[model samples]
Target: MTVVQVSAGWVPLAAALLLTVATAAAALDGVLAARAGGRPLGEGLLTPAAETARLFRQRRRTTVAADLPLQRIGGAGLLTAALLMVTVVPFGRWTVADLSVGVVWFNAMDVLLWAALWLAGWGPNSVHPLVAGHRFLAQALSYELPLMFALTTPAVAAGSLRLGDLVAAQSGLWFVVWMPVAFVVFCAGVLAFSAWGPFSAALGGGATGGVLAESAGVDRWLVTAGRYALLTAGAAFGATAFLGGGHGPLLPAWLWVLVKTALLLAVLVALRRRLPVVRPERLTVPAWLVVLPLVLVQLLVVSVVVVVRG
Candidate 1:
């Protein structure tokens, strides 16, 4: 399948699409929370818009010795990371960059997210936020290797790093069907990087809102939006890498891509605040003891199957 790359000038379309999906995720999360509390669904739907307006009207709050420039960069860089992640991701038959090394590109973006998040924490120069930043790095160290192996599984099976080829390789069977472990790990990686759900220790699970401890006003909004954007990007990429990107009956390919991405994004959002927060300290233990070994075994299984088929 030939994926047409849109001109660089139309990159805003990608950004628009990401924002749209991110907004939907936010709305879904709000609605779920409302339902959980037995509140009206209409009020839940208005949550995102209301929060945005409230934050917009609020004044900026500054720390005693905050690194203002770095703080601002970190806040903005987070949303930027999500934008870059989607550049290589195709919406059905069209993509922005179409890089042959799309898989590695996502890997690099995840690393960039580490830097952005750390900066967000460090720039505040506050104790809890600083601690939160370090906690995320600690949490990242545990999941990253297994995450890498999970990512490698599909590329190994498809025998190419190109996402289009990976998608095409799933014509007969979605990778998620045969590579369930990888798909699970991949979703875990998404939540971890987004600082969401059970993986949100860095966002103030056991501590004082960790990275969010010192944020205020517009700055706070940016960081919050960034997390949603990252989750949205992950869903889009995961749909491509695992769920057989855009391959479905009846609906147009692009619509199928949107539908799959939304479904995955919805699952991730509904799970927020519902699961126990994995303490940053204890997170490393199970991540290493159980998750890592399972993904490694999954990788080995994939390698054997690929070799046998060859």
Candidate 2:
């Protein structure tokens, strides 16, 4: 519960740790895909490495009037956003940046993904990618408010913007235990921001490969790897904010953080394979008309509880 702020020099190590977890999540996804295709699990396990090599070896695909600079920046943005999100996340007892408004910092980083994704689509200068970019923005508009409320409810409950305080507050009970709606909404926001599985209309909704239509070589690799990285980052934050970071019966706090993050990451990776697709069009109505109000009520409930307990 008492987290120490780690030094800047430790940032590289933390990045490595996050990337390792992201890779494992990618491998799990490959394994799931292999299971569905009746392939050997070993091949699935090798999918990440193989894909990385393949993309690196492949030549870049160029398009007419392509804004190569913008395209490349967009491709790199998801990973950037993920890395930024993790800076505030306390790993066991140490964190890189313990901002007073860590939760707000997280929300700001997630919002950056909207621009990252849009720039990715716009960079290619193709009709399909353009459509993909637009759809993602539309979809983002619907879920972002709900996502904001979901993130805020925990902050509201704990009465502090600091993530360390949020974790300490959960010493008795996790926010997820009493704030189911916020937890569920937060998870949905993670999926949406990552463009994972069901929320992947921006990738394949408008046209073949959507924003990825013309990407090749390292360009393709960054965007794809980043998608998984975003998922990893989101899972880690979810574990921290909702499930009680590093809080478990027997494991060390740091180990418990990893365990909870990995479990949640695996479940999310698997959810992509099992759920039915919800196109951007279908997502808007439900995200606004249904999810928004439920999370609001959840927020109200937490507010009331915090007042009484105080």
Candidate 3:
């Protein structure tokens, strides 16, 4: 048991370190790609980084009427929340921290989105930021319920809320196989929740960018970094929840986890470029009233399978 426990503990740490390294490499590769296209090395980082540089090179203009403290707090809070959410994610056989109510913890962390966006918007005290915040709020309401239902489906099927157990239960067949509808719903929710393509209404050019328009300097950088980290964590969770976590033929468990996560992130990146944003109002009705019900039904189906199998 001691040996097993030690292995289990080290595995997750190793996986996380590996993931960090891979993210760094991916950033480097982006830089190289940009340079090949005659862009500066600064342009190679994630879109947010490139955007931040652009913001930095431009003159910093502050609205005389803005709440400085709130703006600072908004930027700091976004980074903090994104980092905290990562702690609960399972990288391989273990997570940075595990709780009995891991699924609940994940869901609870998501609630922080409202405060983060609100602060970001309210601090700017500008028309654009205000509009962005309201747009984000509307988008958040649309996607979160379906996301919650999709998240619960796997927990119900595995009969555990712990992310580690959820991954373990997929040793044979992935949840995506049994709960295809839930998988689609979860992926869609992830894209929307992260405000990625097809759900990036909050950040589209006309609508305040939505709240980021008012941000500049380090404040903007932090928010952008947080967004990438959040997306990474979301991809990791999706891999562990629906795809088999670090389980595959031939490769070491850690490598398997890395492979799966990379694949998922690549898919997300591809979708980011390919898909177009949908308006918040149009998405809400379908995502909540339609997708949410389908996910609930998927949960019921998963539960029935678990019971019957047992």
Best by TM-score: 2
Worst 10-residue lDDT window, candidate 2 = 199-208
Error of 3 at 188 (Å): 1.9
- Each candidate's TM vs. the true structure? 0.98, 0.98, 0.84
* Model 3 ranges off by over 4 Å: 1-61, 205-208
lDDT of 2 by residue, 27-146 (tens): 999999999999999899999999999999999998999998998898899999999999999998989999999999999999999999999999989999888989899989988999
On the 0 to 100 scale, the lDDT of residue 19 in model 1 is 94
Candidate 2 clashes between residue pairs 3 or more apart in a chain or in different chains: none
lDDT by residue for model 3 over 1-310, one digit each (tens)? 0001234555556445644743553475476557667898776778444665676786645786998788778766655665666566565554666777878887787678777777778887888778877888898888888888888899998888987788778888988899999888777776665666777776553445677787776777666666555566677778878888777888777667777777787677557655567888898788767788888888888888888989
Model 1 CA deviation exceeding 4 Å by range: none
Best by lDDT: 2
Number of colliding residue pairs in each model: 1, 0, 4
How close is each model in CA RMSD to the real structure? 1.1, 1.0, 4.2
* Cα lDDT listed for each candidate: 0.90, 0.92, 0.71
